[model samples]
Target: MPRNTLVNTGLNLLGLDYKPLTVTIAAMEADTHFGFEQVSPNEKEGRVMAVFSSVADKYDVMNDLMSGGMHRLWKFRMRQCSAVRQNHVVLDVAAGSGDIALGHLRKMGDTGRVILSDLNGPMLHEGARRMLDAGYLPGRADCIQADGSCLPFADAIMDCVSIAFGIRNFVAIEAGLAEFYRVLKPGGQFICLEFSRPVLPFLGVIYDTYSFHMIPQIGEWVTGDRDSYQYLVESIRRFPDQKRFSHLITQAGFDLVRHENMTGGIVALHRGYKL
Candidate 1:
């Protein structure tokens, strides 16, 4: 039997009647996770891109539905912990719909700038639109399509770097953290908001039930894309737990690293400095 390495994708997306050509070469030299299933590194990015492309339009709505609007509260707390000041330059990686960047902007008091970077063009475009709609000046918010593991900016340029619920999906999370460390100025801050293990036993049971069963079903009902939502839920499970992830951040040269669990540890906010 021969492995079929070509895939055809045609969707009328963005109201543009667009169709995309995706050629995936499955190289098995190294394997990674596309949800729970193992896939080659070459195949993971294309699959992840497909998932985001399918859900880009309904991403925000589905997030609200899935979290019952608690995601907003979590993000507010993250912004408060950011300690953003005037004249700062913050990079929000995997900045879906620009939530973190927008929150940072509000904290910056119209004085600082932000870059919303995501690998998926459709997702990044959605973020850019939200930034413009929020009346953030073009000079203040710029959107770039770039991988989190391999940023395009010069070293020591950013005063703060952040990623929310995004690093888990990175094919090489350690590389992405190293990139964050490399790009931050001395004493700069790094913040990450991500899904983590629930603290109490009962809460963990309930969360797993909802995450594995309810999320994908609701996602299909809302976005007509069940597989992407399924992958999203599994990715959360695959992510490192709060304490282990905090140690990984410290290894990336961030000092004074700490994490605060929110919503009973279903989500955690980790903060550290490049000092």
Candidate 2:
């Protein structure tokens, strides 16, 4: 089917009556290929949350298998840079499966607190259940369902905000970053770990090939879902490069913005401060 027809069909299914002419035209242009137009930040986040929710049961397993257990190391490095303290309160946005929040708890002990928030209830439910199974009571780590672009927290309430492999999925990265700035205290830190374009030419080609082919196969084998993995690879390709994303962070009122390329830039850890 033509792109406009497909978009109209989707809108019809959603029961949206008014169609912006520009959006229809844009959809047609984007329909020259199989990929859809970039969704608004809110829509993007919602779509991703739904996708993760659908795959929640297999999410952590897929991550470990897909990344060869390197995702844990990357997350650990992000936590180290976080420099969390026992007296600090951290917010983990889009905290699927609660790996980062759990790690924070382990490092900060009972005196610290971490809130795991995600737009998807299923992902949050799984994370909450896992925390309970591990003997961490609900109060020790709170799980709230919320959109990252509009966090439900008081201004300057958190000492640190972190999102792992999550920000790229935000419908509006700028809006999400602004929300991060708003929720963090002065001198608070924001850290994000995401897939980035590899800087090394040969390595980049190799990584791209592997991600496009092997990752989806693993997804199909493990979760019986290859399309979601394909979407993941496409989203990474569509994401803004490291430097551009850093500029967005700065524009969102963060200071001292910097990013470190990891694994030859296949992934990057971005850190900025609310100053």
Please identify model 2 stretches exceeding 4 Å from their true place: 1-46
Q: What tens digits encode model 1's per-residue C-alpha lDDT throughout 55-168? A: 999989988999999999999999989967888988899997889999999899868888888888778778889887988746687776677776766678789999999999
CA-lDDT, candidates in order: 0.82, 0.77
By summed lDDT, the worst window of 10 consecutive residues in model 2 runs over 1-10
Clashing pairs in 1: none
Per-prediction RMSD in angstroms?
8.0, 9.0
How high a TM-score does candidate 2 get? 0.85
Residue 164, model 2, lDDT: 92
Give the TM-score comparing model 1 with the true structure, all chains together. 0.89
